[model samples]
Target: MAIHPPAQEALTPPAPPAPDRLTGRARLVLLVLCAAQFMVSLDFSVLNVALPVLGDDLGLSRSGLQWAITAFALPSGGFLLLFGRIADLYGRRRMFLAGLAVFGAASLLATLAWNPAAFLTGRALQGLGAAVIVPTGMSLLTTTFPEGPLRDRALGISGTLLSLGFTVGMVAGGTLTDTLGWRSTMGLLTVAAVAVLATAPALLTESRTPDRPRLDIPGAATVTGGLLALIYALSTAAEHGFGRGDVQIALVLGVALLIAFAVVESRARTPLVSLPMLRRRTVAFGNLGGLLTFSMMTTVVFVLTLYLQEVLDLSAFGTGLVFGVQGLASVVAGVYAPKVIGRIGARRTLSFSLLGQGLFIAALLGLGADSGVWLATAAVSLASVCHLGAIIAYGLTVTSGVPNEEQGLATGLVTTTQQVGLTVGIPLLGVIATADSSLYDGVRTVVAVAAALLIVAAGVVATGLRTVSSPAGAETSPAAAKPSLAAAESSPAAAKSSPSGD
Candidate 1:
């Protein structure tokens, strides 16, 4: 027989379409992905305004029924890494769609729920879906948009959408609860999820590791369990005393389980959290600084919220308008983060952002009950700008230099710290504020403490992120870790091919 090339060897993938060629479809994909993020972010607060109604309808007390929030937060905050890694190993598109379905189904369950038990079940399921969607959506976004301006813009938009979601959720919750019913809040989510599910399969492309490794069941279990314990402890600590027995037990056990997870990750052939990845300065200290930054920013809002409503006697609408300044500032900062990063570099942006945040907090120390709203408004807006900058910069720093196969893990870590930050921030600082004789006095104390914390966080960013070397493959090129959507369309097999050409 005549010599012939193997049939399999002759097979070839279609040429990858370049990033610039698919601008229309690219924008569609970005829109769909951001919508999902908005949905996930909205779920975090949409139910807050409905809580009293829910409590009354379910015949429960404030304390007795509060688990609805906890149930959602616990899983959403906990399972981000596990789900993100799963998306990378299996398929990002698959996980994203499944999450949408789960979230929608859970919203339906809550809408029809007749009792607390049913509602709680739905909330927890929603959290699970939120956890899955966020990291996966982020991974998809980064991978879809090539590095540099394209990638930066995508992240900036994502940050903006996420901030808008939080504010919109709280506002929508009250409006819907007042006009419709508590179930209307969930009904809104169900409708949104259904819409996302219907369109995503077409707008997004599927991509996974070429040689997907076997799932790390132990790492998944330990991390998920540990995060659950930690989230619950922090959540309860916010309401109950931190010294409460359950908090102490959960804290200790959570730490132990996490330690065990670290050990497992260190030894695993294919770890869920690659040890080498964490060794990167941007990944390690960046996340730590992110944690501190998020906590301080959130705590500031929490204290000021109490001061405005309880002491200053601002109405709910007035409070909303006041917070509107912060929201607007956040939007502006997030929109500009990409350009800022382009000009100043991610490390500098992060460091300066943290430093700015500390100064803003210090300025808040000068405000008193009688201080004009403009002073409070200006301080809050400026502080919010800094907070948004850090959030975006830290995200870029961590995701830089990672590979496509690991972007899921990278984004997962970024989001996990966010959830952890939100969970711990208010409670930790609320204790200090409440300990004082008066609320505004405690507000001043909170400002001092938050300023100190932000200063420390700035140091961390300077030392851990700014000072780190640009080790080869350590976020050297965005395309390495983030493949373009066109590339994913042409060849799923090329997902892990080369870092040089995105």
Candidate 2:
């Protein structure tokens, strides 16, 4: 029989079945989901660009202006995990819609804010809404696009939009603030939220964990409180040296609560973050790499934003345009990330990206009063390519081997670290940038420290992390054991496959 068959047929490989194309309504659902992600990402950068003008209108001191960011950071960064778990228990669609409504309402309040109290409160509320929206929306995405090539492309596009949104927001914030005044920036988000609310509910399917686990209140409280205190302490230390009594108190309280949180998580029947998940070196180191990547890159951006606007007297719009260059590079890096990972592996890619990012940022030391704007632009944008490449890789690394039952928790953990790094960046780097005799000197100091940290993070991840291939499996919560509503089917973009930057 072997001799009778043609040699080619004997060695023939089976052809794979064709994957479903994202057609018609499927495309519409993805569009809606991606749009929401854009809005969330947009909000991150838009407000920062407006801070100077907004602070002036509110008569805030340099220190008081920080509350505008800190208020938003506290709720958005702290409540992400709590909200992520809630979305899994309750219906994801229901939570996503509710989140949009709250975010819209909050944006409206900030739009017409008459005082600092009103403005800060609105910012905090908006943050709360974002905390709910991000995880639920991503969950919807994971449920819609089944794992494989289809999901990879969908996620690729989503990841690209996320990076692009921040850059677009910076540009938009500048123009809007310059023309319509500072309030217009907030007003724009209100409009975007209203549009999203009108169309999203009709296309997406609902999903929830089958066994609606009891909320881990103790774990939630200590962790959230701890992060809030930690962020506050850092920001306070930035403005008022670390020696300040308030900073010291906050620092101490934050550490104590976090320690308590670890103990609670170890014992909880259904912990918010299972201790064992972190035993996976890839997960633990991936998050650390993610944290350092975001913290350093964001700090560099903050410093440049100030350098362009304050040191060199560039207009807000001008500053935005300059950063826009970096955004383009980030997009390129994000888009091609999967191929890069496939070729070299996630661990090595992460290590190389971190090292590259450090070198690019350190080169920024040349930026000063006398340097050309183009030179600074090139360095920042190149560094962004490296930064985003690493961030996407880290996301993949963290969620690689996570089971479906704990996908929400795993995703939440990644988002939480991202938020923390983002919150910590401006404050921690701001401290270094402000510590020296001059702003220029401070900028120099910030870059040097950030560069060194990146190298250290590279060493940590390269030597310690490992690749984890996802296996076929599904876990339904107790409530979800019954027939589930058929979903469009999605796996996280960065989970099964790597992602690209830009």
Candidate 3:
């Protein structure tokens, strides 16, 4: 008797048909994911303007008050990679829902905290929730939408909301703190979390890699510790000069541990971040561009905030209005960013936007002690447009052409770049601003450095991404592909499987 080979269906599954346009269900899914991300970004800066009032209410000391912010930053930036991988292995939907629950509970805890310790604990827990939410939410978005216009447009909207959330938080935090109280800020996050949680379970689908890899405990420990130490060092260095012993020790420890992590990953069979993945031009240079854009733009914002408050003597509320305008500009730019990416490709768009951002930032050199606020407003508003473009394009560049199996890893790196840059940039550049004898001179010098870096990064990204192609078993140019409606016939099985089908 002769035995027949395995049937074709058993060997190879049919490719999922990509949707030409987002269906009502798909659109709802996008909304919930973006809302979750927006909440994460809002928390990053919402408390900043309220710190003074929050401290007075909780009777927190100056140094202790800083922990309200740092506590959140530490875990959110540190644990992103570990949580991202776990989500890929277990289930994105499960991790996302879990994160939302944690974030909501922490926000409520923070809202009710009457003492420094309680508030700090709540903030730290919120950070832990954020670490899980950001990466998993992002991976879900990428997997939900096929790698074409749909994903690009979704990312543009998502990126815009993330930036808007921070700006809105800044504005609203001040308004709410002055009117209602500091507790209202945290309460706001709680409400947002609840809203997203309500809709996410029904609309979103579960996704994960086909293979279940063992969790790399050693890799996770080193990376998490290294990031925590690095962020702590930077935050401390910004306050007390880097000459402090503890800061020096932390910096050294972070670098050393990160180096060790690299070595361990090289040897691990199931590495948290595979060496080949980093070798990909799109991932490497794309994240490099992301780090540069997020870091420099945030640093510029920090300098401008100082300039507005100290040099110009504007009230916190007024300063927030300035950023609110920038946020509006970001919204406009985000609306058009996907179209730009479609026409020129994500790589070219990334380069062009960076160049534009650098030029506008350079225009801020005209700012002086008695200069009108309009200059900063106009410059940042225009730069923000470019900034939003770069952000959306960078997301597309980094995640485009990546396989569904590694979407978590890809998004983890993208978010790591974003969170680390946003968290670290202010401190790294704030130190420089404070070191100068003349405040105006220091601000100018910082912008000049930031501008030069953005321009340089633009060139580097353009060069690196020139000949980019997809990884094994992905479209050759997902960012550049224009999917035809006829080819985008709906597949019910694909809709059900969602990410796995893609």
TM-score of each: 0.89, 0.85, 0.91
- Which prediction has the highest lDDT against the true structure? 3
Higher TM-score: candidate 1 or 2?
1
Which pairs of residues collide in candidate 3?
none
lDDT of 2 by residue, 319-411 (tens): 777887878887888678756665565667778989999999889878867664887899888888888778767766665545455666766
Off by over 4 Å in 1: 1-22, 466-502
> Model 3, residue 301: displacement in angstroms?
0.6
Local accuracy of candidate 3 as per-residue lDDT tens digits, 169-276: 888888888899999999999999999999899998899886798989889999999999998888777777789999899999999999999999999989998888
Please give, for residues 13-46, the per-residue lDDT of candidate 1 as tens digits.
Answer: 4454434333888889999999999998899889
**What shift in Å separates residue 53 of candidate 3 from its native position after superposition?**
1.2
lDDT of each: 0.84, 0.78, 0.87
> Which of 2 and 3 is ahead in TM-score?
3
Better of 1 and 3 by lDDT: 3
